[model samples]
Target: MAGPLQRVLMRSAASAMHRAKASEWHYGPGFDPQKAAAQYEALTMLVLASGAEIEWLTDADDGLADSVFTHDPSLMTDHGAIILAMGKALRRAEPGLHEAAYRRMEVPILGRIEHPGQVEGGDCVWVDSRTLAVGRGVRT
Candidate 1:
């Protein structure tokens, strides 16, 4: 989570976010798909301007509303990515998408958190080069 930005894996908002059912996804009433897609585009442009290589995951509408939040599906370490298991039932399919992306990019996978063991990338923090602090909470 530190150092220079080299590559980032992201999914396009138009793929799933734009077609997400706000209510089912627990999105607030004010959630607007069009605005979300526009914002995502703007953010993508900014990331591009920063000169970081962007690795896109997919453009297909997989009905994974929060799939755009790519940080939670996997953990990237110096060795490789650790595919995580989602705590949310609706998000169970997300990790596979990330694993596929890694395979496509030829990125090695160090490990995976299988069923009955849940670990979300968002719930982890790097303490140093070799230490990782993982928080246990509702979203973890």
Candidate 2:
């Protein structure tokens, strides 16, 4: 049997898809805003269907096109959550937004990475209870 997902974070793609230019992200072709919205709704429904309580980040409609991928801004552990710093300049605001949401949800924040150090949550993978492998590259 699959383990229960206690909580999950998600962002709506409506504003991001409708307001931002596709050229900003080099989305060259086949980018449909309507389709994107449909897919996003389907994906959110799937997450809910899996028995996870979702925390939708509704206030993050600041035209950050990549905001829908919430996993990149924070890392969750049994002890608490770590708000990460984005390596990409355009994505910098994401961490702060995530921090506010986590605070509202009463999720403990362990710490945050400051300037000169960069890590995206997507770049870190848990190997076991105590080990985490962090990727070192442009994004992390």
**Which 10 consecutive positions of candidate 2 have the poorest summed lDDT?**
1-10
Q: Report, for every candidate in turn, its global Cα lDDT versus the true structure.
A: 0.90, 0.83
Compared with the true structure, what per-residue lDDT tens digits does model 2 show for residues 1-140? 12367788988877666666777765667777778878998998998999888997864468787888898998888888898999988889889888999899999999998888889988887877688888898987
Per-residue lDDT tens digits for candidate 1, residues 1-140, read 66677899998887678778888999989899999989999999998998999999888777898999999999999989999999999999999999999999999999999889898988998888788999989867
Candidate 2 overall lDDT versus native? 0.83
Where is model 1 more than 4 Å wrong at Cα?
none
- Alpha-carbon lDDT of model 1: 0.90
